[model samples]
Target: PRRIVAGRIESGSLIAGDEIVIMPAGKIAKIKTVESWPVTPVAGRQGAGRSVGITLDRELFIERGDIIAHASAAPRETRRLRARIFWLHDKPLAKGDQLLVRCGPKESRATVVAIEKAVDPGELSSTENKAIGRNHVGEIDISLSNPIATDPYTENPRTGRLVIEVSGRIAGGGLVLSVDAGQRAVPVDIVPVESALRLDERSARYRHNGAVVWLTGLPASGKSTLAKALERRLFTNGGSPILLDGDTLRAGLNSDLGFSAADRSENIRRLAEVATHLARNGHIAIVAAVSPAREDRATARRIADTAFREIHVATPAGVCEERDPKGHYKKARAGALASFTGIGNDYEAPQAAELVIDTSTRTVAEAADEIEQMLKTSGVLFDEVVDLAANI
Candidate 1:
């Protein structure tokens, strides 16, 4: 049976007199005639992906995966494949591991054979092999078991294909290399449907820019209070900022989660998703939680496109205990509370905070003023506001 492959035309359309090239298995063919749902006589009117069939003027070799286009638009061929693979396996991926890759009508058994580089998807920088663990995306170079038809992903997405299978399970996924033929990596912004909806809506709503301000501190260390104060400040300045406090969101958004480490991470992840959505819509989002893990904070920052400002409400533990604002800290110390961030659990301070507020020393008004100043300096507050704030 003849293979019937359907692909969108990448360039100039088909016409009776137009010249075309089929590549990877490079061959030249001239168009004898064009056919589609409706026939038209126009020559130059053919465009990308109009679903037209072309009758070649000469009998030439053409195959299912061969790219047919103008000679100038033909994609370059490469033997090696570079890609970003998202390892879904629980055992993690290592260098020199063999796997199968499927691209278009071609398939090859490839050896991951070498890890040219590893990356923290959240950081987007080259890092040493800690391990490509479950759910982590990393760049890799693979030696194909056999050379097959291939093209740069940038030129034709459909032709640049890859799949990694292990133990009879699909372990990873990747896209063909477009930028560097020597290195393979996937786009960093891959997310599920709900996340895509949030990102799309947020970007459309916020015309200028949007971001989340993650405020982290111990309980009674003033996270909620500071977040509320900041929200009010932004509102008065004609900005639409949403505030998501730990106590408030826990009452609804995260009520199902418990206080274990895994549960805590999930809770923060949900909040980050919501904050990312709000920020994408052009609303400044203030998230007040004791997101005690550095990894959790990094996840939030990675998801928020515009800016992720970590504000450490650096109120001393002594001061927080004295205030006994919620009496929760006392309970935690007395073993009445479990999974508390500061008393029993750990709180990783932001190593790269954009701003740190010593709430113990400064009044709410003072901290708000400082934040407004920072925003002005960052050029988000606009000139008019800066002038007014300066005058005040």
Candidate 2:
């Protein structure tokens, strides 16, 4: 039997016949063969993101949750680990709650054994609580059911971080602080490897790279209207952009969701991921959603990771209620709706949005123009000649 390779090898090289060490078990074995199925066997070495099944010279004892590395430099094993985590789910996390943590091929049954403190990531202030709510940060201690290989996040982020999976979905992400003293000896950072494709290759074909323009505000704040108009503008200018409106997405991508806090956070989180994918593929993603929570918006920005701009649609609820384009606010006020933001729930106005446009004062055309100008100034629309010259 062979073991599946998780992430691609980033450092060093794995060759056939090389002595290998499996983590947590500390078992040493010889690599009999490395097979890349449905194709030729791996000749000598493999890179990241490629799938490979490794057949050990002999089965001493091994299974999943084992880290494969060269024998000379094996990963350390530890049961107790500290981490800083961002909570993304609506449910509150309390001590003694059992969960699953996964990083690459390593997964373990983990329990929240201690709650050190809760933090508001936006304000960088600590809050006292026995539990951490959705969209907050928790500095906590976790105990794994069994020892797993790990390095301090400061040392190598690939093996140092884990995703907290509640149920089957990703509920949060954690950054390992340390295995012993819980002290960061070096700066904790994930270094990105630049794409091999030249910038001109993408821009010449699509006119731009993936850029996200996020519009946040109350429901019926004319976000969709502006998004449509902006989509038209970009398309006419020989660009490709897609509009991801909240209501439209709800009817399809988010049909199971409701107006609950957790659902709301999940709604934004899913949209952010979709938008990020679209943007990375050389498409413009214009998102018009009532991402009411500040924390949710922050999560979107953090996930997008490139050319993302937040435009605050400051249309007040009173005006939106009067328009009642969808009759949502009206139903909400009549007690027909629960967990309605700007009514039962709250909409946090962005304090430092890139641009603020009030639909009551400005028409959709004007807002669209402002958004386009903002993109131009932010260099999302790069000059083709300059791009090719720099990359080539």
Candidate 3:
């Protein structure tokens, strides 16, 4: 059977051969033909406000409320939203209330997450109230059980306006302000803006290419000390640098993760993302992490690509245990810490690190100096005068 989708074009023109995405479900199909009732002379194209029937190149089970949009500009799919609504029910709209949301042709169950502000429509006065009185306007946060295809009301009035229904009766109406809290657009078409400053220009200014200096080893192996020393030295040379200490990250960004192998891998992956972002923006990102697994380090290297420098702080397990600043080695020795690298767990040493420093023998400053020289030799740190002359 031939499936025909009939609708009015709300905002944009649609024509035959135009590729379209069905929202919420995120299905992609091309328009095979555009049809008008009574066979108008316009064969291929139809503009906004015109009623039309479109046939797809492929079959899809599209619901009556499904939205069709250009593949380049698909609507957001989110379970959360922020909106401004006017209350019409005799009862006040409060947080934790469950209601039906009707936007365009789609309807879904929604819960009021929060009432940010309530304003009396008659007096035009605002209050920090927990509920919105009848005939009052309220800015609210809503959570949905299922994802919905929507746009901000300021962007598209036709698709952004919604009504709240209680027991199948209209109780309120609102405009979607934004898709809030962890919602992303379907079709994954987000484009990143390129920085106006070029890498070469940044290098000429800093005399150094942005880089991720990853120091990986067992616990208490002097990775953090060496990383901090290197960061200080780089900054002293007028280079932009940031230290990403493992303990600090675990205490904050990666705090939710546990000590499981999967969590450790995820930790490294996230660190790589952050470090690579800094490196791309022309900062020396000094990372000090145990990063016990070789595969995780490889993944980090892959993420940083040419900007990665793996330095293994090769202090032996016995020496690291003796110098355990946090008493982690003591805990491991007492069987209080499971999966402790170089004790309960294994620490996979890097086979092809850019530099190997046995911190048990060398002083912290000497190790920093050796690593700095390696960076200079690898062209990561360029001489300022030479770089300026080359740019000329």
Candidate 4:
């Protein structure tokens, strides 16, 4: 349903013989026909104000925000750029601001790195500055997360003007100045793919497939207790397992981090990375953390991607407060503690968890047994391990 309704093609019409390429994706194609709004062939007779659609010789997976240009004159591609920004937002546009930058058929998330000069419009001359105030214009350097196909505004006015958005609202605009060429990662990003010793090879030795059973809920909600018991149950049944409790990790690997939102995100990211690698190597990782935020847990899901199951220890907050083994709830109630999961920061319960176990209604062994059954039904346990699971 996307039509390239840009300027008309009077002087250089895209007829059947012309060779063109798509920007950002440099795929070449032959021009088939140029049509008007009602799908009638324009035959290279349209003016500069006309908007027409062009059909290609072959089908391509072209998206809405894609530019079709001549193969001989392909546009510049870059990640870093200097742009003259016309600030329209009420608040000052400063460094480190993440904005959606849209220029012609290119769009990406751009971060303001440095504000070179701000022109107050009245003064006419430029002055050194770090931010652009409302109704002001500034020259700034921005970094894009992905390389974009662009051209200098001086060369092409329509393809170089950019609109910047903050939180889904258009806040300002920009005119392209110069672009630094595409960058390459210093350490490289490729990982080893071919492996003779794969997951199946490792699992054959352990007699059980690796899995991560993440127990998450309010603090003192029996998540750790059930995880520990499940870890022991797997170990007793001739399977290897490791417990990654929140308290234990906070004491060591995540000791330097705090309970802030950013810190919590990093903590969960690190845990998921570690668990994913461990699961790939045929080791069961039983994580017992009061991962209060559902979004954080969702991030963990993406990181692990496979062989991961979220088990919700859905013990009630009242029950957790009553069974506050660490006395955190009491301290929070007495104004002695901050950022307490159950008391201070409200825990966001998993809306669609794989399994939900309430310790108030079931013992630790029963909760662990339920998880073991889930693992067994999901094929995480081998035939021999299944027989031993019942015997244990």
Among the numbered candidates, top TM-score falls to 4
Candidate 1, poorest ten consecutive residues by summed lDDT: 183-192
| Ten residues in sequence with the least summed lDDT for candidate 3 | 182-191
C-alpha lDDT (0 to 100) for residue 242 of candidate 3: 97
The CA lDDT of each predicted structure is: 0.68, 0.77, 0.86, 0.77
- Better structure of 2 and 4 per TM-score: 4
Distance (Å) between predicted and true CA of 74, model 3? 12
**What C-alpha lDDT, on a 0 to 100 scale, does residue 50 get in candidate 4?**
57
- lDDT tens per residue, model 4, 1-392: 53443444422335545677766656677777777766577665344455677777666656556666667666666778889989999889898776778876456666788999999998787888878999999999988754577777887776678899876699999898887753311222122344456666566566788887789999888888888788888888778898898889989998987776546766887788788778877899899998887867987887677788999998888999999898999999998998778874478889988899989998877888799888878878766633433333
Candidate 4 TM-score versus the reference? 0.57
Query: What is the full ranking by lDDT, best candidate first?
Result: 3, 2, 4, 1
Q: Model 2 lDDT vs. the true structure?
A: 0.77
Identify the candidate with maximal lDDT: 3
Angstrom error at residue 283, model 2: 0.8
RMSD of 1: 16.5
RMSD of 4: 10.2
lDDT of 3 at 207: 85
Using TM-score as the measure, name the better of candidate 2 and candidate 3.
Answer: 3
